[model samples]
Target: MASTTEYSDRESLGVGSIVGESFSILFKNFIAVILLALAPMLLSSIIAGAMVGADVALGVADPDFSTSTSVTTWVLTIVLQIVFYALTTALLVQLAYDSKLGRPLQLGRYFSPALRAALPIAILTTISSILAGFASLALIIPGIWVYAVFSVVAPAVVIEGAGFGGLGRSAALTKGYRWPIFGALLLVGICAGIVNFLAGVFAGVLADVGSWAMIVGFSIIAALSAGLTGISIALIYARLREIKEGVTVDQIASVFD
Candidate 1:
């Protein structure tokens, strides 16, 4: 997995290399990535807050799921979170390729394609996530494997226009490389988890501060987490394509142009 064999002639799926480059691309375009992620995150948070009190949605207050309002709040929040996640991943996929190619970020043009693909990506991602969640109930490793198998879904849907078939496309691309992909994702996931943990602590501290402050704080952390995860997944998708298809980053970015 780490080294290329003469017979294979494919690029090496270097886990460390992909993880290292993901961080480079992230920090290099940190502001842009965060900003791109923030919009959808904040909007979702605001909507959730409106349905249930901001305090309840942000965990500052107890959630009374017994109430109908609280149940609706949970449902709407979960659905919006998935939709926003799909949109964010779609936006970042383009940005990651552009960042990798050293092209100026095109903030304005990203939304059209991202918006167009968000629902399908959200639907497919929801199905995969549900499967992963169930697998995790029996054992954690199976869950992670399930996630790795369909990990490149958003990139496939957004970049290749691979609608509902994105699941099959991702499964195809990831074949024979699931473990390496898992390793790369695990390393990145740990880093993201740590950051999110710290963000939680920060949110806990802000609980007494005020509603708006906590909203801002929570949105920022959510955006940061999404930015990291989305960026890494985008890179992984590009790397997989390059290794399997001999496609260059420039060629991948050309889809947005």
Candidate 2:
């Protein structure tokens, strides 16, 4: 049964192959992926709107973030955003891997594992951000490189229960293939961005009749885009491990076991 989803005989995936595989997985499980992604996407959108609204109310295009209180607030907002992202990303990874393993997926049951992973993932995300920030400080290219390489850390944590070591595990798995990973991810990002821009424009131009309607339209589109991207990343992580370590879908899905 393990061989059912094995990629051991296939050559390692390149940029285009990974992107194609990701979209294939996403389309096959579109409803599940979108539903799993909605909560975090909605919350993130609201947070961003609130921040922008607050800035508008303050009458400052760029507020005094240098102030202690403002800095603290900005930091807290960032932390909350990361926490939401971590939770949502973990859920998506579980969903994607389970679907690939041919498990009967239940949305509610998936949250349990994600909840258990919340704290460790939050910490892992924060540390990765810091490290990526320092790397960027050294050189802008290194920062982008660090982010692309460590992109699979969240999925590693979800699949392998690697805790904080997920960062190292991801780095290890992504070794020698960072360029392809980066290219695939960049393609996903571009596609997602285009979707988002179109959604926003559609909402603003056509759905301007009601504020709530616009918000709902934008949120739904954003959720779909984010969900697809998340699923793609999860697939990328799984295939990389399969190619590099002979890991099977059942092994990646064993977190559910």
Candidate 3:
């Protein structure tokens, strides 16, 4: 019984150690972390731009294009956005897990894995978004709960290379630890909110002071905030994987295996 107790304690320590190691990797690979964080925002912007451009070319002048005649345009836009996000995540995970710091991180490396993982990732996104929306309707707390559960979905898809099945897997891994995940996400959310609030306050002050300064400062703040958030999520995912699956960096790299 004592030996069994010792083994159980060791297992718990191992989980804590994995989480620590994940954060260490994120801090150590700061640049990559930033890129991972920014990727989603950048991809969203690109997709939005393309959709707007297509709407313009079609002579459809409306703030909302969902009612547009060309369903293909909307489908393409959604597909492209998913593909882009998946690819970005794949590249980031590949680079981070492989420890390929010196290699030139090109755009192409992101596409294949993204394409491979696109459908599952997109489905996960849709389901999570719907759940979050429903939660919001219920009240703020439910919304937060939904986000916490699905928070690891993206990382699960990218790092574990699991498809639709991975979504449930992530939820399972997060089980019995929802509060901890919630706490970590809450902290990040608070920090991000504060940063945005301060930036907005500064922007307001700066606009009164100097428009150019406001523009530059706002841009810088947005980039930094997005990057930091992305890195934090990626790192969290890595740590969760380690805890749930005993996946080391090496195993993450061997995701295809």
Candidate 4:
């Protein structure tokens, strides 16, 4: 299933092209994209509820920062975050390929690959997060650099099934293309930030009218931002793979060849 397409040879589609293509795919399957984006939030809530229920049954009080309950919550949150992000990554990778091939999108195709890809994705994601954290602690530039460098980790994990090796693969693929990835990531961040800022402003206005609406709206905005960010990251991975692995639109077109 590897046909080299013309787009594959055009690695210089650069930042604008990448972002445009991502948004195009997103809009084409807006409903599916939104639902995929919402999946993590919904799953998290369900898991948290179950945890809380178990804690209550065991007579556990609300967790304070010093308590085991707090630790458990943090652990659960991290695990859930990894699983959700991995799943989103796999789904988006499949979607990207489908979009490129002019094939119909299918929601059912998302989960299995996600599950298969989870471990490597989780490891890469965790490492990237840690590196970013250390860089942030050192200086903002380093943190941002680390983030840009590892931007394609999810895509590597999903497409290559690189597992723990995904981070290294992403780094290698992105070696000469740092600025492009950085620009794309920055663009996504700026757009998401704007959406978030607008959401906060709207929430404040709604709060003045009704607190519940404000809370609900804020929650929805947060979930949408997460999903959109995840999808954008996945798109970046696809583009990088096409460039690094020499997998082009033509190759994609001649999958059976």
- The TM-score leader among the candidates is 1
Once model 4 is optimally superposed onto the true structure by TM-score, how far is the C-alpha of residue 5 displaced, in angstroms? 29
lDDT of 1 at 22: 81
C-alpha lDDT of candidate 3 relative to the true structure: 0.56
Give the per-residue lDDT digits (tens) of candidate 1, residues 176-227: 6777777788888889888777766777778788776787787888787788
lDDT (Cα, 0-100) at 179 in candidate 4: 65
List the global CA lDDT of all models. 0.83, 0.73, 0.56, 0.64
Give the total clashing residue pairs for model 2.
Answer: 0
All predictions: root-mean-square deviation over Cα? 3.4, 6.1, 7.9, 7.3
Q: Measured by TM-score, how close is model 3 to the native structure? A: 0.61
Worst 10 residues of 2 by lDDT: 52-61
Candidate 1 clashing pairs, residues 3+ apart or interchain: none
Give the per-residue lDDT of model 4 (tens digit) for 1-257: 11224234455737887778777776777677767656655465445545543232112235335888777776666566555655666666666667657877776766676777777777678778778878889787667778877877776676665788877887787776666666687787788778667766666766556544554455456555555667677666656657677677545324222
* TM-scores for candidates 1 onward, in order: 0.89, 0.80, 0.61, 0.74
Candidate 2: lDDT of 143? 72
- Looking at candidate 3, what is the lDDT of residue 78? 56
Clashing pairs in 3: 37-230
Cα shift from native, residue 220, model 3 (Å)? 6.7
